[model samples]
Target: MAPRSSRGKSIRQRGARPPQPRAVSAQDLGKLQGLAGLSLRKLEALRARMRIRQFSRHSTIYKEGDESDDAVYIVLSGIARLVCLNRKGKRNLLEVLGPGDVIEIPSLLPDIHHKLTCETFTDCQIGLISPTALVEGIVGIPFREFNEALNLTVGRWWTLLERHSNFLSQTVREKIMLALLDLGRKFGRRDEHAMIVDLGLSGQDLADLVESSRPKVSECLKSLVAEGVVKREHRRFIIDSVRIQTSLRS
Candidate 1:
C-alpha cells in the first residue's frame, strides 16, 4: 500500500469536518424585493421561519402539479427556467427568472400546486418563506400591496404568452428576432459597442423559448448575422439594438 499522506493523517487525528453553509439571516430576507422596505421587526419575524437552499445548475427545483402548499420560493441569485411539458412530452419554455423573482404563483395560494416546472439554469441560491407567516399577518405588510405585486408578475407572463401566441402568424426569423429583443431586455448588459446577452442557453433552449425548431432557429440566427443585427460570441450574443429595431420596423 502507498504511504498515507501527512495532511490526511493530521485531519483524521483532528476529527475535522467540512465547513457548513451560513444560516439564512434577516438581511438575506431583505434582499428579496417583496420583503424590502419592511419593518425590522417584521423582517426578523419572517427571517426566523425562512429556509435557505442551494441548487446545482440543471437540477429540478419543482415540477408542475407538485404540491406547494407550504412556502413561497424567492430566487436570491442566478437564473431559473419555468417550463411546461405537454401531453406529447415536448417542453415549452415559459419564462426565465433571475435574482429577486418569485419562482411560482400557485405555490402561494392554498390547496394549489406548481403550474410550471422550475429548473435551475445556473447554480442558484433560493429562500423559502412560510405561507403561515404571510397569511397570519406576521410580516405586517399591506395585503393589497402584496397581491398587486403578485398580479403584476403574472401579468408579465400573460403578456409574454400572448406575444408568442401571435408569433404563430409571423415568420420564424421575426419570432427569433423578437425573442432575442425580449431576452436582451431581461438579461443583457450594455457595452461600448452593443448589448451582450449571456444567458448561457443552448440552441434547443432558444427554440423552445420561441416555439420553433432548432434547425429553423439556426437558420434565422444566420440571417440575423447577415443583417448585422446580432453576432455570436461563444455562448453569448452581441446585439446591435438600433439595427434590430430598424429591421423589426421594416
Candidate 2:
C-alpha cells in the first residue's frame, strides 16, 4: 500500500464540500438582452463558447474590405463609429454606435465585402461570437429572437439613410443643431444647466459628419459660441440645451 501523506490526512480531517455552481440571476439575463437579444438560456450557452475583446480609442476594429472569417461583434461598452472614406480621403461617418450595437454583420452575406471600417471612439468592451458558432446558436433560438435581431438591424440602416438625407438637405446651422442634439441624446452628461457632449471631435471631423467644409464648420461654431448656444473648452463642444433649442427657432 502507498504511504499516506500529511496533506491527504488534513483534507480528510476538514471534510471539504464540493464547490457549488453559480446560479444565474435575473439582472444578468436582462443585461444580456441588450447585448444581443439573448435569452437567459442562450446567454449561458454563449458564455461558455464566445470570446470577449477590448479596444482602445482610435483603434481600428476592422478595415474596409477585410475578410470576414472570424466572428460578429456586439458593443458592450463605449462608442464606435462606422465610416467610409471617399476618393478624396474624406471620411463619411456612417453611424456612431453605442452599447448594444452589432458590428460586422454586412460581411456575413455571400460574396459581399465589408463596405465600412469600424473604429473605437473610446475604450470599449466587445463580445464576439464566431460566425459558425452564431449560426449554430441561432438554430437553437426561437424564431422570434432571430426576427427581432433582423428588425433591429433593418431599423438602424433606415435611420442611417435618413441621417444622410438630412445632412444633404440641412443648412450649416441646422446641421450643427442636429449634430448637437444627436450627441446629447447618445453621449451627453447632464449638468445643472445643460447636456454636454463629452467627446473631443476635431472641426474637420465635425465637418465630415455634417457634409460641410471645415471652414464653414469653424465659422458656424464661432457664431454659436457668440450666441451663447455653445461653448468650446479645449477640444470639446458644450451645448447649452435651452439656448440651442431657442436658437433653432429664431
Candidate 3:
C-alpha cells in the first residue's frame, strides 16, 4: 500500500472543544431537510442528544476504515466533499454535499466502518445525530411523512450518481459545460448576457470534481472564455447559458 501524505493536523485536537449543545438553535435545525416538519421541542431534544460542531476549511470530518459508530451527519452550511482512495492511491471524489444533505446514514444500519472519507471544502457547521435517536425519531414520525423524506433523500443520491456517471463518460469540455449548467440551475444569478455561478471553488478543485486533469480543464476554460461561452472572474465563472447549453448539445 502507498503511504499517506502528512498534509494537515489531525481533526481531533487538544484544548476544550467548542460547546456544541449551546451552539445549536431552532433555526439551524429547521435548515435540515428531514427535520423541517419537526417541532421546536423535538429539535431542542435532538440537539441535546446530538453533537453540533463546526469545522474549518479542509478539515477532515471522517476517515475511511474508522468506526461508523451510531451517528449520521447533517450539513448546516458550506460544502463538503466525499472521497475514496484506490489501492494505487488515486483519489476519486464521490460527491459534493451542500447544506441540508445527510452523510453516513447507510453505514449506520450495519455499523460498519466508513467506506469513504469526508472532508470540508469550505468552513461548515454540522449536526451529528446518534443512530438510535434517528431510528426512534423515524419510528415516531408519521409513516407518510417519513416515506416522503426517504424519497427525497433517495432522489438526492440519484442526482449524485448521475453526476458521477457524467464525470466518468464526458470529456473535460463537456464536463465543464455541464457543471456550469448545473450550478446555474442551483445557485446562479442573472447578468445581462449570462448566468453567474457564485460558488468559489478554485480551478484545480473544479477539475478534481469533474475527474479531469487541471491543465486540460484550464485549456477548455480558456477556449470557453475566448468563445464567449464563459467569462472568468478571479475564481468564479459567469456562463452564457445559451452558448453553454448549445455547446453541450453539440
Candidate 4:
C-alpha cells in the first residue's frame, strides 16, 4: 500500500478490521423465524399471548427511562433502531435491529426501565409478546435454557456497546470507516473482490451514524477512493475489502 501522503489523507482515516457478522439468510427475512425451535404447543401459547403491532417510519416505540411494560417486541419486518442521546440532546444511532431480532430484551423484566430509545425507520410490523407467554414459549421446564437465552440477549447489547464506543473514541476518519464497516457487514454483498453495501445510505445517513458532519464524511470517502480502498459503481458503494482491511494498517 502506498503512503497516505499521496492522497493527502491522514492516518486517522484508517480502520482496524472487525470480524464481520454473518451474511443474513432466509432465517433473517422476518416473522420471528429465529424462534423456530419451539414446540407447536409452546408456539400456540405464544401466539395466544402476543399481538401484532404496526408503526410508520420515524415513529418512536419508546424513549429512554420509559417504563418497561413487562413485554418484548420482535421485528417482523423493516428496521427498528435503538438510539442513545447525549447531554446536549444529540441523537446517536447505537444499534439497528432488523427482521428477527428482539428489541431491548432486558427491558422485558419486571420493574425495569429502558435506557435506549427504539423507533422504526420504515413502516414496520412487530410482534408484541407478554412476559409470561414469552417465558412459557422459550423456557418451559428448562431453567438453564432460559438463562442461556438471557445471556445471548445481553451479549448482543454488549457487542453493540463495544462497537458504539469504538466509534466514539476514534478519529473522524476512523469513525467513518467503522460506520461503513458496520453498515456493510449488516447489509452488504460480496462478489469477487468488492463488498457492496446495499443500504442506500446517503451522506447525511452516514453523518448521523458517526455523529460527524456530512462534508467531513465526503472528504473521508474521497480519501478512501484516492487510496484505492473503495469505489463507486452506479449508485452503490463498493469497497475493496482486502485493501481496506490492511490499507492504513499496511
The whole-model lDDT of each prediction reads 0.65, 0.62, 0.66, 0.59
* TM-score of every model versus the real structure: 0.59, 0.54, 0.61, 0.61
Give the local distance difference test score of model 1: 0.65
Query: Which candidate do you rate higher for lDDT, 1 or 3?
Result: 3
lDDT of 2 by residue, 30-127 (tens): 47435446665766666656566666655666665546435677776676667665444545565666766677455343233334577665566666
Q: How close is candidate 4 to the true structure, as a TM-score?
A: 0.61
lDDT of 1 at 41: 79
Clashes of 3: 0
User: Which structure is stronger by TM-score: 1 or 4?
Assistant: 4
- Hey, what RMSD does candidate 3 come out at? 6.7
Most accurate candidate by lDDT: 3
Stretch of 10 with least lDDT, candidate 3: 5-14
* Model 3 global lDDT (CA atoms, 0 to 1): 0.66
Give the lDDT of residue 138 in candidate 1. 65
Q: How many backbone clashes does every candidate have?
A: 0, 0, 0, 0
Task: Report the C-alpha displacement of residue 214, candidate 1, in angstroms.
Answer: 6.6
